[model samples]
Target: MLQAKAYFDTHHHVGVIDQRIFSGFLEHLGRAVYEGVYDPESPLSDEQGFRRDVLEALRAMRMPLVRYPGGNFVSCYDWTDGIGPREQRPVRVDYAWKSRETNQFGTDEFMAWCQETGIAPMMAVNLGTGTPKEASALLEYCNLPGGTYWADRRIQNGHEQPYDVRLWCLGNEMDGDWQAGHVPAEVYAQRAKAAAIIMKGLDASIETVACGSSGRGMSTYLHWDRTVLEYCWENIDYISAHRYSENRRGDSAWFLAEGVEIDRVVEDYAALLNYVRGVKRSQKRVYLSFDEWNVWYKNMEMDGKGESAPHLLEEVYNLEDALVCAQYLSSFIRHADVVKVACLAQIVNVIAPLLTKRDGLLVQSIYYPIVSFAQHARGLSLVPALECPTYKAGERGDVAALDAAMSYDEASGTVAAFLVNREQRQEMRVVLSLGDQRFCEVLSVEVLGGGDAKAANTWEEPKRVTPRSAEAHVNEAGELIVTVPAPGLAVVRARVSKR
Candidate 1:
């Protein structure tokens, strides 16, 4: 076994764990909305047309917030087209994904879905082909009480009360040329500033997110973020960053180590945010919204094929993907202070954790780590100092063999640790030392690994890659000695007693 030591001190705190950090994303693209979450034709659907099974899955995950409507789809989406009578809704051509938008699910429907599932809505407006006035109208419709045109229109459409959506995104990836109505950084910054001002002026309580860069690989990554912040830092509360990891080279080690890239992405953006804050000499701090992220490389050819193309971008995740996702969540916990919110790109079907057939659904391997962290990892984030072995990879050289983060809930006297063993063949012997804190008993230990790294949960074998209970114990010295399997992820919980 590979040896490692982890030190956790209550004094060495990062920040309070934001529940929104574990949030998910839902877009209009692919089967995410049509067959995945809203399958009115299926027996699994409820009276409202929302799939009961999907709702159950989402509820089980304890997702706190969900970003609504569009990834690229939002760039050309007209919110009004989705509201009012479904029969009268127009079938517009969605240039973003080259699909025909049936306009069945709109702003009202998404808000209603969020209400039904008890998740907060993070609404994104169409800055690509939309104006500040249109964005403000959306705010009025969602947040304002009846009596005004848009507010009363919302009432006439059936919802009597306001949705009171607090989080808003000014645009979706405005910095990318691939995005519809894509603008240069300076141009996008000005437009975002105007939209932010207008929307906030309409509803001061609503928090707005300015589009940063699409990803770190963009030609203008941090520069785009800096320019947007320079122009709209005070107006916007958060800046949006999106990333999608891929195993295109078929390198398992490189694939599992993608979390290192995610960590660097957060660090770079956070550093930029801090630098901009200092330069402006502004007391108002702008945090990061890693609102869109996931592993998306499997079905690239099927995307952008227009209305004829169905089942677009549905990725079948394997054991390695799950490990990478777990490491991503661990990275979020490590930077809880700067990364205030993160949406797992999507929640269902389209490169998502949950996949659906016509009448049934299969929970992907990535879903295990999500629910594990969401349910167990809460409260204060502890900055754990780790002494672990390292390996030399291609790009991310000298990467640690083990990636881990810990959280302590003082009220419940519970401490939860999330660990990922990145090594392909070596199980890690991890000795966890909590300074002056005694864990009386090991509460639970769930490990998500052991099978083939490429093995995935199929409809026939849904339970094939599920997490299993692991052996964990508290020694006489009150430290945790746990064996983390190679190429796996583990969540360990313990009852911490007052020393």
Candidate 2:
């Protein structure tokens, strides 16, 4: 049997534990904008053109914030095209997603949608085709006290009050060659610094994120982060990172261990944050924003048609992706101190865990782990010690035999354990030690299990991949043992009556 432990120590429970790590993204490319969030004619859409079913699903996740406007779309995006009137708005080509972007749902519409769905908006500006002046105007339009030109324009467009959005991204992946207007690291750092100064000048309360490398494997990953942070370290509050994964090789064992990749990236980025902090000689520590991440590249085909106007980045997730999501959630909670914000690449049909049809929506396999952690996992991250043996893939070398992250939520009086079992045909017995704490009850046990790797949920039979619960007990010394099946993700919560 392998042992893993999480302890509740008051000293370990630190400052404000933000649930914003449970945030999401909404880009203009796919059904994410058109059919997913903003279809006026859908049977399930509300009066505001927001999908009622999708809103309910997102409300259930209890999302704290959602990044808006673009993924790659924001790179060359012109925010002005979507603002004033629906009738006069341009039908522009979206080169990034290979679709036509109707400027109907711009800043005003998105803010309204966020208000209706009860999710805060974290806006990313259009540095790809925009200037510091243009970015400043947007900041004034959404956040300034309604008096300036942009502010008056927003008011004239039906918003009488300020949106007062406090979070901003200076640019989206300006250092990546794949981005629409990729800039050299030096040029990007300079522009990002200037933009941060202007955006903050518009609203001092706003926190800004400067661009880092697109992902861990970028040739300029470390250098770009270092160079950008060196220039904007004192100006911005966070540095952004984006990554999309797919089982290109489809090697189940190796693919299941992909969560380790997200972690290694985050942990290394955390180190970069520290390096910048030391160089600046400041105690005002800056954190990281993993603004975009998901199991994408599955639906993007090389020879596929440009399809049509909302070339929906639709991906039907599988059981394996769920296991990967669970392990990645563990990584987020494990490093909660540094990674203050994260968005699950998207919230709807565009490679998201929540899939939607015209009338109804279904939760994908990955949804279970993300929702479970967002609902129950909070508090200071505790170092979880695991004594599981190791596994190896064809050249990937010793991956974690078992993947998990443990944290104690003092307010809820529960110790949450999120774990993933990636081993094929092997049920590993995991002994969870609660570390000398008395429990009140077993609050919950949520697990996503399937008979095969390709298991998914469908509109006709949506509950095929939802989480199911089971009962477990702790002994007098505070230990609960269970066997984790292959390709399964589990979250166990034990309550304490004393707290």
- Which one is best on TM-score? 1
Q: Write the per-residue lDDT of candidate 2 for residues 1-499, one digit (tens) a residue.
A: 3443434443444344568888999988767888888888889998888899888888988889999887778988888898997999988777777767778898899999998988999999977767888899999989876878999999899889899898899889888788887889888888888888988877889999888898877898889989998888889999988888778887887888887788888889888888888888988878888889888767873221344434456888888888877776777777787788989988887889777778777888888888888888777676666777678754577887688776777677777777787776666667676444566577777667746887888887778887888656776765666566666877888775442
Query: Best-fitting candidate, measured by lDDT?
Result: 1
Model 1's alpha-carbon lDDT is 0.89
Q: Which stretches of model 2 miss by more than 4 angstroms?
A: 1-16, 302-308, 497-499
Candidate 1 lDDT, 27-59, residue by residue in tens:
988888988888889899999899999999999
Cα RMSD (Å) per model?
1.2, 2.2
Q: What is the TM-score of each candidate against the true structure?
A: 0.98, 0.94
User: Candidate 1: TM-score?
Assistant: 0.98
